[model samples]
Target: MEILDPQNTVLTNAEVYNIVVEKKKAFSSAPKDHRASPALRTVIYETLTYLSGSPAATQTEEQIKSLIRALSPYKFTGAEILQLINLRPKTAVEVQLVIEECEERLTEEQVNEIVEIVKQNFPIQSETKNSLEAAEG
Candidate 1:
């Protein structure tokens, strides 16, 4: 079967999740005897699980895309945006750890902006842990 990405380009994890789940639904409605092969079913299950990110990162994906685009002029891959949405880093160090492979380092201000955007959507749990550490230290 020839598969086409809806965007006519590479898909992000969330987009992949939507497409896979939509296909799964279509398959579910088909005649049971005509359903996907066992191997394909297993692959679908694993893909769903891998893309099912934290329930707390509840912002609509369009919002996430907008946030990622805000970092432009910096140029991030779609995979990086997906990981950023899933991980929700809360500081410059955390953002660096996520996007370290980018050709250029983000300035402190830029990292802070990205962190703030992420925190607005999904505050990483580790931020509280880091806050406690700062208080205790």
Candidate 2:
């Protein structure tokens, strides 16, 4: 296969979840027996099942954008920022894990602020859990 864009583009769990959900919808709407190959359907089902439990299930595109904007001042790389958005870390330790050279770069207060921002600003929604299962099946 010819290479398309040479640079890698990172996607968050929510983006992946949304894409799979759309594909599943398209597959279900397609004519019978002509459904996405069994293996493909299975993959969609499994992807939905796994992502539904993560923060991605309830996350909106706007929310993700807002989060990226909120954290931009910290000057983390796209990958690092995406990880923070995807993981929704709730503690200083978790923040430390996601960011590189945490001890040297950030003061205790900044770490606390990042933790609080993540914990308070982004809440994991519990409503959509397994909501798509019956439809997919």
Candidate 3:
């Protein structure tokens, strides 16, 4: 396959998870003879399993877009924004860890604001959800 727009976009894990899920559904619905290879099927299954157990599973499009818009003023790098979405940090320390040079770039209040923004955009994953998943797993 040829590469088109090699750097057209940077996708968060949630977006990747959604895409993988769609591909998995398509693969399952295709004729057996026309289905993807065994290796591809294995990859899809493994990826789905991992993503389901991760924070990405709970992420939604609206949340992600809102988060990006809210955080744009901070001028964080794409990688940092992606990390923020994936980790859903709840504390200043966590925000500091994700954003490079936080000590210099982001004030204490800014860091705290980022934390609140993350919390507001992606609420903490509930313990009940985790427990239910653990039980199911």
- Which candidate leads the pack in TM-score? 3
Error of 1 at 121 (Å): 4.5
Candidate 1 weakest ten by summed lDDT: 51-60
13-80, model 1: which lDDT tens digit per residue?
Answer: 55567678888999889998989999999999888877664432234566656767665656777677
TM-score between model 2 and native: 0.83
What tens-digit string does per-residue lDDT give for candidate 3 at 89-127? Answer: 988999999999999998999999999998888766776
Ranking by lDDT: 3, 2, 1
Q: Which stretches of candidate 1 lie over 4 Å from their true place?
A: 1-8, 55-59, 73-86, 101-104, 121-137
lDDT of 2 at 28: 90
Q: Can you write out model 2's per-residue Cα lDDT over 99-121, one digit (the tens) per residue? A: 99999989999999998777665
Query: Against the true structure, what is each candidate's TM-score?
Result: 0.64, 0.83, 0.84
Record all residue pairs in model 1 with backbone atoms less than 3 Å apart, i.e. clashing.
none
Residue 61 of model 2 has an lDDT of 79
Off by over 4 Å in 3: 1-7, 127-137
Q: What ordering of candidates by TM-score runs from best to worst?
A: 3, 2, 1
